[model samples]
Target chain A: MPHLRWARALGASALLAVLLASAACGGGAQPSSGGNSSGLQVIKIATQSPLSGDESVQGIALKNGAALKLKQEYDQFKAMGFDLQLDPQDDKGDPNTGVANAQKLAADSQVLAVVGHLDSGVMIPSEAQYHAAQLPIVSPANTNPNVTSQYKYPEISRICGRDDVQGPVGAIFAKDQLGVKTVFVIDNITAYGTGVANAFKQKAQEIGLQVVGSQSIDKSETDYSNVLTQIQQVKPDLVYYGGLYQGFALMLNQAAVRGIHTKWMGPDGVFSNGLVATAKENAIGVYATSVAAPTNLTPGGQKFIQDYTAEYKENPDPYAIYGYDAMGVVLQGLKDAIQKNGGKLPTRAQVRDAIRAITDYQGALVKVGFDSIGDNIYAGYYVYQITSANASTTGDAKLMAQYNPKGELVSQ
Target chain B: MSSTLQTLPQLVLDGLVVGFVYALIAVGYTMVYGVLKLINFAHGDVFMVGAFVGTEVLRALTAGGRPLSPWALLLAAVVAAAAVTALLGAGIERVAYRPLRQAPTLILLVSAIGVSFLLEDLVRLVESIHLGKFVLPVPTVFATVYRIHVAGLQNPLTIRLNSIVVVVASILMMVGLTLFVGRTRPGKAMRAVAEDRTTAALQGIDVNAIIALTFLVGSGMGGAAGALFATQYTLVTPYMGFDIGIKAFTAAVVGGIGNIPGAFLGGILLGVLEQVGGGFIGTKFQNVVAFAILVLVLVLLPSGLLGERVQEGA
Candidate 1:
């Protein structure tokens, strides 16, 4: 009877502990009412990317670049009586995960703006949730025109050029500079891949380059020999792939095995030091196009790169500078919103409005200005050729050419 | 000659090369399932761990800036991966699965899944903590030595020295496993235990020891496969095990779940079918083709191509 009474008392205490824990969690979940008890106002800039999978290299670079910019401006914003923080979310490059991330960011009342959703396939679906929340999201590397063409979300924008521009630039380069008369195009069948491949195909044909054969491949399948075998028959002058680094590296390796030694070219998705590292010697002589030039080339971009390397102790990926620029745009907009409200933290709606009003803002890579549909007006594609397949250093890639908005290759 | 006919040899070779790797992993799945009747979902993560083991070994070996010969690197990788994963397999079986031996099959399966996720996340967390990054770049351990061109072929088929070594090593392992299971005392004990654990125990066979041995051999095979796969792909992530493990399981089921030869056949067949199918059909449907074969096999012949039909008591 005494033991039974002790057991009952223990159960009562356990129940009480559960109740207390639930109450604490409930209090924590509630939106913070402006300034915390410490009298410091806090706001979050959320970043969504494939931070935990095969594409995490690019995603982590983008996140770090954005975080670097926010950290640099932390004290400056503190001077105006506000603390800015970064809330990084991993979407795993999947649309469903992207939507979940968007909802999570939307539910967090402290998050004022977002800087990512790197893959266009992810951005397309997740944009609706962010739009419903009236949260402004700027993409650093999404290129599919469909992401912004419909203007479904006024708060959605991208600092990078669209596929319609980048793909055509690739086609023009293949036709004019490389003298590629016949080409074979392959897409990984994602929204970004198909969109860019189609754009490249159309431009190739219009510019008098014959597209001999076209195919779509599953991105998950590492063995590309069967497809490469089929490609051997076509024997096109150039092979253009619209996919990420993983698939492209495998295809290139398989193509080497099959003795199909055609010149290789790909869109901005394949533009990364990771690709060069992944492909090894196969990456040599391969051409990739990016919407922004490498940060080491331009003076302002070089300064940004120097700071980034000094901070992170490594070179930034091609998209990292774009992420930095995107964060710069958002931080500038936040400053404008704060100043407009007379040294008070602005509402999410005010920040969104300020982001849309940004124009001719000189960024690390290019001039940041949005068109009517939130597309960067000054965005253009730059071509890079892998001069060396050295993965140990990031300087293996050399900028070969640049294509303007008009799809003309220009002198660097 | 037609393009398809001309490329047939290369395609088949490519398929077989990958098929052999799958077959190696499949042996682990079949051997474990044969004795335990539980699908070791964590088997794939074991393979992933093996790959990391191999990577770490090679990284350390090459840290002096002087590279080891391809053969030396491959040997070191296989031995290191196999030894580490053998212990891990035994540990996993002891920690996660052994406690649930008397539980319902469903419970054991759930525990296995939990173990799988735990291993994956644990690897990620540990690797991230140590390296400050999750994605580990596998150094080029083996360089292509020669490109062999057969007579009457338009293109020279790439004959990577590493590929030949992988194929030979796999065959040797397969032969060794077949001999061990078919001839040795421990192999006979394993067979008896697989046939009936209670009867084997009554016959004075050490059931626990045999089960642990089965895990050791299966996991050793998986570890070797991981080392070879990392060398071929030159990129290893924590999640790499999931896809390959699923495919290897499918291969085991396709060949015959509890049959050793069946696992090998199923793996090679599935690999060939995927490559040939991807080549003939569009590559977009390659995965669909692989899984569709599984569904079709299950529907038509539930015992799989090489599986023996067993009777269940009503």
Candidate 2:
């Protein structure tokens, strides 16, 4: 009994230590007011993303994009008499962690604006804290419609199209372009996946495509042969999956093994090089829709891709350009605020207002401007097909068609 | 066949294939519990380590588009994973568990959980340093070369060659394990130690050696399961072991903890129930059904279907 008591004490103490350490890390705010004698004040632009765990590949790409943009503008900003710094935080793709990161960023007085919280689930919970702190936040990747819905957090904005807009595009494309009459829809049961899949299913039914079967799969599940078997029975012409890359890869690989060769389509969640790498040859012919056009399409996009590749020595992922543009929006807002305030350091509130007032700003990915509710007015979705399944190349996702916010497919 | 009947064969096949993998991993949990009365929570991470080892080996052998047979690559992967994980299991026991063998059960369990986290983070750190990322795709040596379709089914009921290989290899391993436990001297010593460590030691059996051997065998099976799992899934991540480990542990409990045959039966039952229930009911409730079965089994039959009643204070 005494030994048991001692063991319990040790375990409890160890757990308490871990909790305390994490709390200290999450809640600590460094004093940022120690200015250099040269009268230049340090201002931080924090970026939040999952820098660890399964989705770190996408998050790291986002971080690299922001860091590259800051590097390019660091000296130019310094020349304008402001010491600019980028403080990147890892939210681990978790809502709790994202909230903690938001609190930490909000506590820092010098942090003017934020660049991310890539996932919508993370953004949904954490945006309120930033709103309360009056810190303007822009996301390059968050696509859930409710993230910037009317009457919600007006301080939050994203360059990406909402899932409600993007999901219907996939359904319409499958119905019109691919000519698939019947489809099986699957979701991973997460908030984002469920929302996207529901939108797709609703649109498919509305457009007269038979919704043969719909199923929810746990994201942790690697095997889906049983569900695939059920799908084969329905004999759907196409399968629409609403989940991230890992689940998509697993389902695609397992479906291939089961010889269920129906055409596969997914939303922006599956638009990543990681999917092709994981799914390999099975990824061939799979279709996905994204919130931004390909980096090779426009001249600005082409230059951004070339510079990003040369700097990072790797091709940028789909969300990388969004990260670059998100940072650009913040920097442009800061410049505008400074110019309006006669070369003095503007307050956080002024920066937030400046970001909201911006119009007709050109980004590397698109001509970006925020409308009411902080949503990108020009943001739309594009359809892509995996032409090749090579891991080394830029995912080999060739752009097949583009769809505007109205769900009309446009020829480039 | 009607649509309802058409799905039956495919569901059963799917369940059985996954069941075999779970059964293999569950054996490790059951065997370790049998000897030490301690749950090696790190067993799952050992399985993950096996998967990574298998992936690295296959990648190295097949680099530069080398032409190697699929069977050969699979064999090499399984063997390498098993060998490495066997060493890792023994090392974990020596460093983390053996020191606290005389300690309270709480201490042993806590140590196990600590080791589990340590191993997972350790793998993540090492992989990040070496491969620049924690998640890596396992290269498949052989595609799904053959598909078996059942006749008389209106909707095609197809099974891949990899599924057949997984099932057959699992059966062979189970049979070999049964023979080893039944006939071999070391295996008999292991059983004796499990029955009563003090008495087995007094009767001249090497208690420590038998315990070590139990860990080696159990961890080796876990490694083999991991290798097979990677081959089927075609992706490996540092966190993959946790979910599967919990499921397999649940399988061990449902079948009657500390019973090898019970673990096997429990795994198959859980797998079949999950697949069939998910197919019929809602897929969101698949995990719920599996855990509900565990609870019902524990409540109704405390000793499990095949497990013996535990003699308190034996």
Candidate 3:
């Protein structure tokens, strides 16, 4: 019995040591409490995605984008009464991390308004804390409708379109634009993936497009040759992948190798230039729908792109645009709240109210916006076609297409 | 069916390319196992350290505003990584394995786990910030030169110059190793030590020198694998070792523990199996296939593919 107890204690100690070491080595995974330092007005903003393992690209983009915006706007922010600063944390794209980050942010009094929890999985767990704290969080990229759709409180919001809008648009384009009727739908079997795929399939079925096959693949998968072969035999004209760019890119490349000639369509996860770079020629004819305008083509997007390129010397990722715009919205709301509260920095509740009260605020990309469910009210999606001429073309198909519910091309 | 068949050649070709890289990693695992009769779990991290060391060396060369040629950079990377890895491996053995020399098997294994944790933490502590994080930047060999292609496919199968170098260097190292082990005095001492450590010590073989040499050789292989793996995969993170380590261990076990030839065979077979499984099943279960093969092989032939006889007394 003593031996057994000793062994158990040793195992526990070893495990504890490992976790503590991991935390120390990976940077302190501590919950930030807004320390009321005498001179520094420390404000924390956070975004969550898979930061540690795979899907790290998207997470990195989200983090850098938000950080860049905060850095750029810091001088102007300090000129005002509040000494604005930004604190970013990693969620590692897990819901557990999302919850932890959210709780941490909520607990910190300096965190007035938050920027992200990129994946819907992370957002779902963190939103409850944000709601209870009345801390407004604007998701730059999360597309799942449940993110804000069924929220008990409306403090949580997103700048991106819901999967309901984006998914249907993708399905309509495949059926109408690409002449892909008998189609297969494949989700990555996550909240975001399944949600978008379901919406696409439902809309496609309604439009007389036969949903011939549907399946789920784990997110970490890099090959889809076997599934592609099965789909090839089914002779589907298209395969709808409701996953992020990482899995989607691999799937397309492998499918191309397997000679699966079907057109591939996905939502915003396939929007990154990194996705295009990885997929290469395999990504040709692939399509993804975005609720917001493409950053390269947006009105002020060109300026942001030039500024970002000059600053980072790397091309500004699309998600960065949303993040920049998200910070702009929060700043605008905070400004309004500060003015309303007689030049004093408003309480967390006042800031949350200011965000809710926002209307017709012009932003960097478009007007600053939110609806009842905290989704963008002016929901417009852009359809991009990857073609032999390269998806980054200056042609008709490459131009953002506006689509209505019935699959007719609306005037862009 | 015809299209899928056409795709097979391309898939297999790429699979073999990846397999060669895996074989490089498996060699280190097998080498350590051969002499120590203990799996150096930290071998994969040694590969990671090599990549990091290469990064530091290349970055220094480029930082002086004199961008070295790809060949120069590659040479610098190889030498720097080899030196760093050799030191790291030796240090790890001295700190973690030395104390456990007469301990139980479980303690040695535990020490290996501790070493892995320690190395990971060390890397992470140095690369704390994400912005200036350690990135294993590969030379533009893949993008610029030695692009492979099939006539029909639109996408050219890109086999990078660096990858070719990696394969060539690995082969040379293996050949050198075989020659050294077979023909050199220290090599024979190493073999003798593996056969019977007490007897080798009685025959006037410097036990400490041989042990240090074992680490040097094993970690040197790991370093080469690291540079090659980084060049081929095009991404290197501190935690990258854990997954690759598991794969390499599986390769070593499948080939036969403590058998150098078996490790090579095992790695190639594992890589081919992964690609074939992906082609047949889907990419999602690619990891499952590797482990499944390990289990199957262990059940049927515990001695591994090379059929090496195991002596109980070390």
Taking the candidates one at a time, how many backbone clashes does each contain? 0, 0, 5
Residues B127-182, candidate 3, lDDT per residue (tens digit)?
Answer: 54534444333333234444356787544454446556777777887788888888
Model 3 C-alpha lDDT per residue in residues A73-162, reported as the tens digit of each score:
767656664566666677877888788887888887878888876688778877788888888888788888888876747688777777
What DockQ do you compute for every candidate structure?
A: 0.39, 0.48, 0.10
Give the lowest summed-lDDT range of ten residues in model 1 chain B.
B305-314
lDDT tens digits, residue span A23-47, model 1: 4443212233345566678888988
Error of 2 at A196 (Å): 1.3
Residue pairs with backbone atoms closer than 3 Å in model 2 (clashes): none
Two-chain DockQ for model 1: 0.39
Give stretches of model 1 more than 4 Å off: A1-38, A257-259, A390-393, B65-67, B312-314
The deviation in Å at residue B48 for candidate 1 is 1.6
Poorly placed runs, candidate 2 (over 4 Å): A1-40, A392-395, B312-314
Candidate 2 TM-score to native: 0.92
